[model samples]
Target: MANQSSRYPILCASFNQDNSGFAISTKDGFKIIDSNTGRLCYDRAVGAFIIVEMLYSSSLLAIVGAGEQPSLSPRRLCLFNTTTGAPLREMTFLTSILAVRLNRKRLVVVLQEKTYIYDSNSLSMLDTIDTVPNLKGLCAFSPSLEGCFLALPASTAKGAVLVYNVMELQLHCEIDAHRSPLAAIALSSNGKYIATASEQGTIIRVHLVSEATKSYSFRRGTCPSTIFSLSFAPSLQLPDILVATSSSGSVHIFSLGFETNQRTKMSGSFLGSILPYSVNDALDPAHHHVLHNAVSAGVRSYAVVRKVDKVADSSSSEIASCRSVLGCVLASELYLFIYFCVPFYLPYLYVRLPCPLPPFFYLLTSARS
Candidate 1:
């Protein structure tokens, strides 16, 4: 799921549950870097790795190897502590572990057809979910303890989703999202909303987790494109914005709050004529902002909305006094670009770091205010 077409030296990359820090796995070893200061927090020189997931800012890490060496098998998962530089525990599976997600309460390990849930503290097996064949391991997990829901593809034929409560260990609901199979999925910070994109990738839908129905739909493009990533702005209530990266090399920003507040007011205006809403509220083009050529076409890329800022603007009375400041990291074979953009305002490049080798994946830390 990290990269589809090109091969990068870095095997795997992932952020911690809260996105405060990220870990990268390379042929030589893996390293954890702080998202705030760009400091190297920890590094391990063992071998190549396929998955390296951190648990928040803690020293605990769940790592899977690339199967290059016998000790670092792809089917083996090691829970290692960075402070001691030694593994605390290990779990072997029948097949390769595709992905691992951790939070304060649960540990989720995903395989091609099965997903295992465990208690984080005691490491006791909690429950197991048998799912359809998921080669890419496409899923979304909300780390919030109150509404810690896990979303997985419900069907291989279409883009249906099954949302399960990880805390209560039961089924929540199912959402028939798209006719085509899903390409990417993401949950809101508080687990109130979930966003999905299908293989067609022409449209992205945002759904209410409780209702399990489409709440808002945004058009990605007229032509079919692959959605590399989808992220919701962190919020306890309804998130104001959602960000998406696509194979067409554009970073799309959808303003949900503005759309909601202005929908009634603009429905009878000229803006509504150009972008009319259907029964499902397919939003207008004005609300959809795109950053063109953010990454190389067809190269794997990921982006996240690290933070959103609200500022008072007396001159603008029709619009709300808020701005979505999106922090995105665009990576290709050569370098990683960390930049910020204010929708309807300006885009700014903060940091551009050249990679020692091709970076396979990268993630941004969330600063929830």
Candidate 2:
């Protein structure tokens, strides 16, 4: 199944830091789309590309090729300027680049065994960290300078993560999150919190950066599944919620700060009635809500918490309302689905992108703010 889907026309897709826009690379070339208007902002038909990352709403882009053409090698990274339609600078590496992340202050490039950090303004090499063999280039980064931290797997045998202070250029701490190797990791916008999911995908753990010994554990399910992504709500304090997408084609929302037991008891909503309430809820099933069959099971899906609001009710104390956009690629077609909810109501689809997307594609969302 993996090999067959690899032949899809669209190779990669990713949103910018703000989640206001997204870019996709394909066999024909690449294109950038505005999230608000769903308008094609930029299109280039030069060659096939494997990665196309945008810097916020600017004209600057970091792109890498699929190695189909000689000049468009996977080892070469190009800083492209859409305004001038020219390459500002290019960097070549020894091996294929697995992933690239950018913010206003820094640029990060991840290879199989090493990760490089560079000053985004001067393109000067800052530091390199030798990592355990990361074929998937598993890492998490926060773009905010105040909470700017980079997380990398400390060990391949277990879910130990090394958190580095990118701004200070020093090692922060290591967190042993899971018993098994990690499958997905996410960092909050302010860089104060980190979340991890092991290969088992049944339990997700959130850790405070300063206190690695303490963590908030959430049970996803009893049966193991593959977790594709994890995201935290954008906040200066502890995020109120966390979102996760898995191979089960279900999107899971876990309330971090909400009083689920009290809310479940007081509300008459449908979600409240069905939830199993207990005075001593160990797993806290009331706080965990799932949108079943959100996409086709086994299909790759990505979602992000774009914006969250606090609604004060005359009847209730407060309700944490959230809005998010999700994109999923099933077989040869690309589909975008938008979902948001207040309280425990099930998310309803709000928008679907016009069909017949460039064939063979994958979806990505801004993991942080």
In order, candidate lDDTs are: 0.78, 0.75
Worst 10 residues of 1 by lDDT: 360-369
Clashing pairs in 1: none
lDDT of 2 by residue, 1-369 (tens): 346545544677777876777787768788887765556799999999888989999999999999999999999999999999999999999999988988999999989999999999999999998899998888888889988999989899999999988778889999999889999998987787899999999988888887775456778888999998887766643226788889888888876655343454544656546654332232557567776766667766666665565544568765444333243322212434344442444434323233333333223323321
Off by over 4 Å in 2: 1-8, 236-239, 259-282, 313-369
Clashing pairs in 2: 8-360, 9-360, 10-360
What are the per-model numbers of colliding residue pairs? 0, 3
